[model samples]
Target: MNKTFYSALNKSTVVLLFLAMTVSGILKAQKLPLPPRANDAISGSTFKNQIDTLSVEDSENQIYQEILNGNIPTFLRDLVPISFSKTIKDSAYVVTYFVLPDYLAVGSDTDYFLMPMTPILAQKIAKAIDFTLPTKQMVDQIWSNASVKLAPSPIPPSAQMTTIPVMWEHNTRLKGKRKETLKQAPLGALVAGHKKDVIISNKIYEKSSKPVVIYGWHYQNGTPIQPVYAGHSETYADYSHGIRLVQDSVLVNNKVHLISKVLQDIQKSSLFSGEGVIEKPFYPVDKIE
Candidate 1:
């Protein structure tokens, strides 16, 4: 080969090596494996039907058990990447985390239900599956990076808002929106704005009653309808509530770190949290009776 051919080959090798390194970093950062869905696991719609007659407490328990048992949709196993850049003391840093493409659901890929449960139950499932709830800042990042953004559809305020029937009704509406969105964006792409996230906030620690902090029902234009609010009791879960699991693993400047550890780090916490040092970034789980 001539000198020109040799030089071109060397340049190509360098580009290929850089691409390989970039892919390696992404794979290493999102190494958590989602549990396989059991063959006998019921679909989300079926589970909803079974729980329709059950009380809120009973239904919440069922949701927790079902999720831990891996009775979740296959599609949810596809985690989407969300990242942000921060400049700390003149040094540029990038933090990234893998998140479920959509809200937690119960069922197989063909049939599933977007299940909503109390924060206590959501926390338990998150712990069992090696995931963590997102902070308010993380929620914003997800919304901003989402490929498919649905507009929030809030039902009129009524006493029945928290009922199971209302949940199913809301799910029906979301299904329609998701169907339309998929036409424009591929399946398993990051989706947001359909539901309010059950998030981890300092407000959860402020009250003795263990309130459930919820946020992020964004519009298509990157505006959230609900701000970070912890007004409801920990057990209160409505149709609009969703659980978006963040893999416990996070990449801080391409180095792998546990999300909990990163959030506790004073310097790194700013990447994920606007509020400093989320020392206890977890929902306090009240024991099920």
Candidate 2:
């Protein structure tokens, strides 16, 4: 009787210890805590009001500040993985990358502003979040794989295209279209179109001045309106421009490689860059301010 009671007690204690460890491990696997700057950003409506009174430079600065404070929609936080298979030199390679379901926006999921920013400001935010901008090839791939392909809705060409009010108007229009799209697609579905992507390219490495490479405002038919163009200054931004955040770490053939390194690799660049050997894949933010 004494031996049986001791055995039962030992089994009970071991079971409880195992359960406790499992729960502790699960908790540790959860997402890490947000930065201290999170939860201090203002709402979308308030940002709009503030933009009306701010200059273009000031407004762009504020946009970066809000992003730094984590003033983005909850949906944008969850990244969607995009995978594609390619064959090179008789070897089949699979490349998988993660990207935000939608372009970077400010405010809540219910009411957010699709913030358009200069390449300088955009690069700043990308660095803060440990993300990088897509290459033209990645932009094409993303548009092709998008679950929600919105038609390119271009506001007429004008000087005000880069102004704050125009940015607000464009955001409102996109929200309406997104609402209609959500009826057919899930909330966090990968979305494209409605804005041209500010991408990275070897063009930024051109002699002379730094330029921002803009590409991709695909139609429902998967045709992009804007080609890979680098005519605009790196600091140039308009209501039509968007920042699509790509996770820096990408999986190539099931092995992890940093995106910047992949772009620089001669053999692996084909997986992401159509132009071959991107060399310099990120924008320079030092002097744009």
Candidate 3:
């Protein structure tokens, strides 16, 4: 995370205390876990649509305003119960938090996913919470519920051509080259490399260019092919682009943190007071002396 970015977070009204223990200096470093390998197959993930198909349109409000007024904790507890908002549903959210985060909740399904692909943005505003990019299948499942048709992919997989590899230097002196192509050892070989090497048959590719087809949008051409991009960017998504599905998932990892006072009650009751450090590290011990 940028130092300037850290200074910006302390100035915001977003409550980050809920996530103190999840990671050290997470605000200064967006070290979210890699994409989960969870089986993203759509098994009961989707639920019946709003009693009547929702006429929800996109909403672009200040995330700070939404978090403050929405009482996000309550929304998380419900976990994707049908929401009725005439103006906005999670389908189209361009909300910006303090570090310029943009996302919204498609709080319609059972999991309550967040879909703004901005991890840096999340840390900047959602200081305590962490997020994981929905798996390829998960993205498809949730985006399927969107109000509009998704865009078509601009690139095609089958249409691409394979490039041949060439070595910069030859292991043996170019003197006894066997292939007719290599035999012509043009002086150009010293500076300009050969057209192609036959030994290296495999084509070189950074990654597949297959597009993520959903979200009423398309994600193409990223390092790992994140569905979201800068304009509103992932197969896995980037730290600063697009939305992610974050709802109950935010506090699921921080259950103890969410209910801080409960721990206080347990401590005061002294129910497990005699336990060793395993149960209560703070418990006093008799001196060895």
lDDT of each: 0.83, 0.81, 0.24
Candidate 1 per-residue lDDT over residues 1-289, each given as its tens digit: 4688667677778677666676576665353355677888887678888999898888888987787777877667778887778897787988778999999888876677888889888888888777899999989988888888889999998998888788888988888888886779866788899999999878888878889999989977788889899999998999889999999877776666788777888877777787888889888775663
Candidate 1 whole-model C-alpha lDDT, 0 to 1: 0.83
The all-Cα superposition gives candidate 3 an RMSD in Å to the true structure of: 26.5
**What tens digits encode model 3's per-residue C-alpha lDDT throughout 19-129?**
464423322323222222134322111311221132111111233223323322122321221111111232331211011111333222223323232232232233334
Off by over 4 Å in 1: 1-34
RMSD of each: 6.4, 7.3, 26.5
Q: Tell me the RMSD of model 1 versus the true structure.
A: 6.4
Candidate closer to the true structure by TM-score (higher is better), 1 or 3: 1
| Candidate 1 collision pairs | none
Which scores greater on TM-score, model 1 or model 2? 1
* Candidate 2: 10-residue stretch with minimal lDDT: 25-34
Cα lDDT tens digits, model 2, 183-281, are 788777889987899998889888588888899998788889999899998778898999998888777765667888988998878889888998878
